[model samples]
Target: MISRLLLFGATGDLAGRFLLPALARLSADGRVPDGLQVVGSAHQDWDDRTFRSHVATRLQQHAGDVPIEARDALISRLRYRAVDLEAAGSVAAAVGAFDDGGDAVDRPAVAVYLALPPVLFPAVLGALGGADLPVGSRIAVEKPFGTDLTSAVALNELLTRVTGGVEEAAFRVDHFLGMPKVQALLDRHAPGRPLTPVWNSASIAQVDVLWEETLGLGGRADFYDRTGAVRDVMQNHMLQVLTLVAMEPPARQTEGELHAAKLELLRSVRVCSAAEVPFRTRRARYAAGTLAEPGATGGRAVPGYSDEDGVDPARGTETYAELLLELDTPRWTGTRFVLRTGKALGTARKGVALHFRTAAPACDPGDAERVAADRLWIELDAPLESRQPGVQVTAPGERAAYGQVLTDLLSGGSRLSVSGEEAEQAWRIVDPVLQAWARNAVPLLEYPAGGAGPPPLEQTAGSARG
Candidate 1:
């Protein structure tokens, strides 16, 4: 059981939209342990009652479906303190409250969660290093670990130094990995299966990993403008999903074994050279257009990417990105993996699809010579949904992605956490594309707000799979 949870950005969008709702669900399901105290710290000036009122309001807005008893119980454990996280003395004071009677042995295991922006990670960690933390304390950090490879390395080094070089004590969260559908895919693809034998270039023609959202930037223009689609989605979430789909089966399902397998797969990923990037990747920004809904009288008009509030027209931010990558490993030499994501799309298509090679032509005179390749699609429309082998499976006790992440954090599991090495390798794989785009080596195309992405690539026997 996690004795205490110190939330650094308790008043941020992430906290209100995701973290608090997840904690409420855990409470409703009896997953959170009894007597778990939660402390909220932020730069905002608010007392306990004000903070509780804020939590109550946000809880109703985001998690209205949760039971009143669960919400009330969660609120009862919450307390607030406003602190400048950069100030060592302020952080120390907030952390010192964990001590009930100044008895070191009696203190509970504390988990510090940093929900702030990535730029402030180092300052927060530095302050925590000076604070008198309890034994068995863990630190959980949200995604976009760093902007690039160099910063990611520096952040990892700082985390290790502060946490006494105990890698397991640092949790790098990626909620996509915690989705039950992802776990279900891992469970279905265990050893000794018909598909397992054909999970290679010899039998598979191509793979597509896509995440398209119909909604545009809600109110995050400042963040989204700086970090475009590639860094925002491809580097962390999409790469992690690709690793899962392409990784070799783990020796066992333990966290260590699974992470090792994923790390190895990432290490084998090949980035396009500067000269090859133009042909292998595509970037586009959405223009103003109408988004048609089924049975609606009229379509809803949406603004262009450049027209979004707080967005600079000169930045050339992309709303849609697609990259064609190849794995250098012998097992996947000839196969291609397409990674794509976009906002303000016509439809929300999110999942991984594996297209296998077609069978040889039939011998019968009347039979068709060629047929569509067989596909094994794993749908990840939402947290609890799962579809495998064309059949939907609803497993009991399925939890939301954020809830699973919390369960792992409180229970000392790192399966959903990305390691330092994995973070660096992911950046390495995309750094070239980033550089190319900055130099304007590749053209930035424009597409309507609601439309299928750039016309599908000419369908070769190989490209027909996606």
Candidate 2:
């Protein structure tokens, strides 16, 4: 078991809003080791006491479900270190004290999680490479693995070198994989299952993987302005969900087998050529308008994308993105997989909707609705529902996705982490659209901040719906 967790970017928004709360949940459930130590390292000048104070406040704010005792236990295990992450010697000296002193078999496992920006991965990883961590130590990195294909491959190479050439020793996290509902969706598609019969192109018309948000860039203009819609969710989270929906069931049903299957599926996805990019993709930015609150007739005013603080109007980044992708594989040849995401939309919708071809004409004239195409909607942030008969699964109410990620990190397992090849392939799948959008091969369109996203592309019209 991993007895020590070394967290980078410990004082960042991610740590406060998600990671620390997750740790508290794990502590409450007795999922973490009793003697586990948490070492938070950042550029902040805070001492151990100050860091703990911050953690306590975060727990109070974000982890209200956790008992006070568990919150205290998690806070008790925390220690703080101020380090210059770019300096190999400084990083080594700060984290070295946590190394267990004993025979290799008796030493406790240590896991390092980089919760910082992807831009810092190279330098921080280089520092860790020089730190000479314990042989069995594991490392986990947060998402947006890279800005593009080239950088992703380079980062993968760096991670391999840092972890003694063992690929699985480094975990590339995509928290969507940790959602219990998402896992349940994958489980349903196992070979010989009920869904197996209708899972392919011949039976399914389209698969729409969507993640729309009503909220605007809430002080994330620095990051959001750079990432936009595609890189922010489409490339990582949405693609991962699509893979689980589209990949063939592996023979062994193990992590390695599943990884290979997903990689194969990703590779089979036909990348948009320069000319095809404009026809298959759409990009848009949100304009100033009113955003409706959930279930309410009223709405609040929202600023346009370019007007958001820290935004660069010259960048022409899209707040909305849509891609009409197809796989060349036999099983999914004709079926379209629509990947769409947007911010400042009228409503928040997060789920995968599979539109199956209509089965047959209705026996009763009035039963046309029931005989229409079947849409199996696997909801990620809400309850799962299916238009046809199918199992509906919900995530565990007690734990969040981050808690599952922490569990996987502590277990030293690659089952829930993205592999290097997977990361590279994901980049390959989206890079062309990015390139085309950059050179204005595809015009950047606009829509009201709280309206449905920009008008659907001609190719994607009538296929994608909330």
Candidate 3:
């Protein structure tokens, strides 16, 4: 029922670039309601008119060489307010104009978006708790839901306590849930489909959720140093992706329906055995080096993660991490989950590779090279696949079986995708991982920049070749 979108951190990195323009494009397409109100908030002291200019700059940055029209029209929808997020009345200040009880058809409720840091969540919620808002007032929380399991649980409890309820009134999001390809993954694995029961079955040799980033910590070095790639990418992002790839088929297909399916997968996931987990997880810290430009220049010298603006000097934090996982359920007794992520990779892309058992035994001494493992790319994020026809058999990695599932989810909603509850469950699965890391969970596994993960991972990855 929320009609107005009050975007927190509206002037910051995300809003200044993607979110705002997405909303603008939606408006231009006439998809948004006529009275759809877009509000922006920040700690900087600025009037609405002044804030409008700040947002425009971000859009231009994302626009790149693409042409944009009627910039003012999109700008007209933006409203900004200066707020001290930590102060007592910050929530009320950010919740700019309000609409009294109005007809449902004429006006809708408020949608407050929390785009700032997790620490500020409590303050903002406290402010809203004291404010006089209606029952249907919905609020959104961003990623890195909590630093660790304890923090995540506390944050969830805090939001529920502050809001007095955590039902439809609160919404948690992962942009991947909005992708097209993700929806297809759901569609691919339905009740009677080959993908569902086979999702976790040994039928699949293994599943790899790969998240790669070309840019290292750079400006976020300090933040990246502490969180590392595990917390940054694998924990939240890939966890959700894995949930979809391995979960059971739900009775229904709505977000709520999908949530139930995902929860079962989380509950079934076998905790990585101490030995399997310890060495299975890999971390690499990118050192200063020059990277090849491919077609442009010979190469560019990029500072290692430690050189990032805000990163700690002696940080052993990894910009890249990989983990091997499995589920205890009957479906996937021995199937493994390989999670790999890095900031200083050669490219930027996010997707899952499902290496399936095309043959019964999975081994052929006669023609191991000729035999192929059907690997499908459930592209929830990037690095799409293309298989132009009339071509002969291609290698397992080179085949066009690459799919664009995530792309399908975006530009709209995807059924088998994660909802607030699913996202929370995914968080719960990582609770132990987070606690382990917070308490120096495992000895740090460090690797050089522009390379693969830690040296120990080479041994850990012995069984993950699938």
Candidate 4:
């Protein structure tokens, strides 16, 4: 089927940095079908020529070294229209122009991609419902689906209204799931493997899903201030990773099977109670400090979170957040799943680490020395470098995360997309933590900009119960 992608917020930073560049790479690789058209829409009043020029510039800047022929091929299929996405008639008018005289059966399948803010999703979806698009047309939404559980449920309701209750047609894009290494990790969890055998509370000690960035909030101060580290990362990306690790093996690898398994896993998630929130969660804002390297001469100095240009000190936003969660299932009851993310750290570390429990000591007295638990690391930022002690799985020719996501959407695949239920459940899991932070029940600790996060939480005997 011919696919036409309608990108809302076409002129925004996300489109320029990720969506358009990904499309360009797809065009270069000949993954985008010949008949597929890309139509960009925004509030900017630009004609087709001007819009094409803008796309060309962004592609050159972000895509990097696209062949001339491939670049032109993608640019040729590009079209643009100016529309106030929230207005009643705006979406209908834009879609109406693309309508062919032929019957709906003969026309291309339209996919409306909402790249706008989460706040505008309801209006855009409502406008699309009024536009009377094809019955089978798809809808793709960006991340941070909603601010909280209530809003997420409302967003899902809005999506159902537009898609006529067809949940599969709605695609909520979470770019982290599209990473090849993440897919590799899922493959390892299939039936009958070394890791699969120990994938339970009995064998595993703890699971850490960490995403740390050395760079501070560069120019995204306004958005970052409102959406601290938790909402921006833990709610969607980190939770999705947790589900993948803790979920039961799907009957098959199909999108439906995987999604169902993930939903079931999320349903079993147990968040800390109000009293336990303080001990189970930690939030910290970075303070101005120098990043001291072990061997390097002088460390790099950085500004604190409060020192950032657009940040508000009074808002008490945290640049770093850590939460301890548990799956209330028999397989993972005692296993602590720690989700951590921070900015302006000493180093950049992005991956999922599964730390296995050390076996019982041998009878020999010489073997009394404690042996560290085996660790399985999935290094996301580094390409083709996922490794255990002796085993390493290299994912060759891994495509860009956004590029893979675009490919999935264009081909009518939802495996990498977040379902409506998943989005809501993620917010539900973190709702209590958010409320606790709001009430100042959990103290917002301060850490040096380039230090190793806040002090570790005291672990009680037996296991670290959060």
The candidate that wins on lDDT is: 2
State the lDDT of candidate 4 residue by residue for 1-466, as single tens digits.
Answer: 4378889999998898788888888888878876887889999999999999998898887666778778788889989989988797988877765787666566667888888877788888899988878656889998888889998998889889888898878989998888866766666667865456777888777888988876567678878898899999999989998888889888788888899989999999987789888888889999998754444457557688899798899999988988888888988988888888998777777787777776522222321122343666667656332222212222322337888888888788898799888898898899999999999999999998778878755342223362
Q: Indicate whether candidate 2 or candidate 3 has the larger lDDT.
A: 2
Task: Report lDDT (Cα) of residue 145, candidate 1.
Answer: 86
| Cα lDDT tens digits for candidate 1, 115-178 | 9888789998999888867777889999898988888999999999888898888999898887
Model 3 poorest ten-residue lDDT run = 398-407
Poorly placed runs, candidate 4 (over 4 Å): 102-106, 291-300, 359-373, 383-399, 458-466
* TM-score for each of the candidates: 0.90, 0.91, 0.82, 0.89
lDDT tens digits by residue: candidate 2, 10-82? 9998898788988998888889976899999999999999999999998887787789999999998999999
| Candidate 3 local lDDT, 66-156, one digit each (tens) | 2365355668877777778877576675664655555433445567777777668877877877765555566667667777656777777
For model 4, what is the error of residue 329's alpha carbon versus the real structure, in angstroms, after optimal superposition? 1.5
Q: Identify the leading candidate in terms of TM-score.
A: 2
What's the C-alpha lDDT at position 256 in model 3? 67
What Cα-based lDDT does every candidate model obtain?
0.80, 0.82, 0.61, 0.80
